[model samples]
Target: MNPILDAFWYILPAYFANSSPVVLGGGTPIDMGKKWRDGRRIFGDGKTWRGFFGGLAVGTSIGVVQHLILPSYYGSLRIAVEVAFLLSLGTLIGDLIGSFIKRRLNLPRGYPAVGLDQWGFLISALCFAYPVRTIPTGEVLFLLVVTPIIHWLANVFAYKMKWKSVPW
Candidate 1:
């Protein structure tokens, strides 16, 4: 497969995981309204349990579908589940970490931090998935180049759809 296409296909779970949060997130914040010593919200109101779990479910479901439809594309069902779980979990964790940093820096929730907001989940997903599934260097590089643009566009679309308060 073409490197770009391969990377796009391989990273679908991460993509869905990163985006599902916005559509499904709400209610209690992950930090449970806690604050840091700096008097800032640990992860702000943006990070929530619903979002994290919802993203995981959606991403994993998609991966399972992909595996069932094209077994050769991403290896066995077991591997697919592993990839989905790790990528989805990693994406949310990375986003939470980003939010923590943002709060520490006194940046408000929904504020854009350039590459951090765009690439954090992808980087984290890659870190988690790499141990179980070896991704090609070329595909990794291609994803790195492509994902941010897609992230930006998705955020913009979400903003326009009123799902998000701001567009990055």
Candidate 2:
């Protein structure tokens, strides 16, 4: 397989998990409208139960589909699903952490923190899946360099489509 395609395919589930939330998330903020000791919203309205779970579902489903379609390429279905689950879980965890830090810094929901917004999910996804299945150093580096650019393009596209209020 081409290295670029392989790396992209490996990270596809995490990408879907990270992006699904934006398109399918809303209602019942995960923090439940509570404020932290600093009198700021815990995770704000951006982090919601629906989005989190929805992302998990979407990402896992992508893995399942991949397993069904490409078992030989991805080892076993169990392994495929497991890695996808970890990546999806890690992506959301990282996003939540980023959002929490943003809230603490008084950055609004739509406000972009360059590194946090761009790399947090990808880094977290890699961390989670790395133990389960070690990615080649080259692939990891490829993802690290490409993700932010992809993220930027995706955000700009979303903004142009009016799905997002601002382009990051």
Task: Tell me the lDDT of model 2 at 128.
Answer: 92
Q: Which stretches of candidate 1 lie over 4 Å from their true place?
A: none
Over 1-168, each residue of candidate 1 has an lDDT whose tens digit, in order, gives 777777877889989999999999998899999999989899989999999899999988988988998899877899999988888888888888889999999998898898888889899989988888857998888888888899999989999999998887
Worst 10 residues of 1 by lDDT: 1-10
TM-score top scorer: 1
Q: How far is candidate 1 from the true structure (C-alpha RMSD, Å)?
A: 1.0
TM-score of 1: 0.96
TM-score of each: 0.96, 0.95
lDDT of each residue in 1-168, candidate 2, tens digit only: 788888988898999999888889999999999999999998999899999999999998899898888887679988988999999999999999999999999998889898998889999999999888757889989998999999999889888988778887
User: Each model's C-alpha lDDT?
Assistant: 0.88, 0.91
